[model samples]
Target: MSRRSLLSRAIRSNGEPIKITIDKSGANTSAINDYNDDAGADIEIRQNKYLNNIIGQDHRPIKQLCKATLGFGRFRTARITIGDFESMRIIRKR
Candidate 1:
């Protein structure tokens, strides 16, 4: 799918975002701008590599576990597996 449609679908599913931090991809920038114009919504876009590090850090452990398992065969199983992993992590932290 094209980047514009992909971005629009994401916003539709997740609801409109107030601000988005993205890499220096011109395609992504153009998509966001198009979405803003089409929807007549002002969504702030920040292009900063460092701003995305927190999201990357949070997903690191989950990615490592999935990599070791060679990935899940289905989306449902993956979602449940990751949900359980997160639940265990949260409980352990308490």
Candidate 2:
């Protein structure tokens, strides 16, 4: 890709961090109240501080997409991450 394209992509990604949650339960229910009612599980918003910078992405008042979606470059070169992994994937391409 050209340098201009790269800059545009980076600019579009305002470095907003989206919020994510982990459901320990293996079952998937359509109703959120039912899920909460199933068991009184503590609801805590996960804001991992370790994921501040990976590809020069800021975390303070992170950029958010909708409710839980983040944007980053497509210069990956490593194994995929699991849902449990809260850290953002940083890939530096040559």
Local accuracy by lDDT, each model:
0.89, 0.34
The digit string of per-residue lDDT tens for model 1 on 55-82 reads: 7787788788878889899999999999
TM values, all candidates: 0.87, 0.20
Runs of candidate 1 with Cα error greater than 4 angstroms are 92-94
lDDT of 1: 0.89
Candidate 2: pairs in clash = 15-63, 16-62, 16-63, 17-62, 17-63
Clashes of each: 0, 5
Query: Distance (Å) between predicted and true CA of 17, model 2?
Result: 14
lDDT of 2 by residue, 57-84 (tens): 5333233421243433343412222221
Winning model by TM-score: 1
Q: Against the hidden true structure, what lDDT does model 2 obtain?
A: 0.34
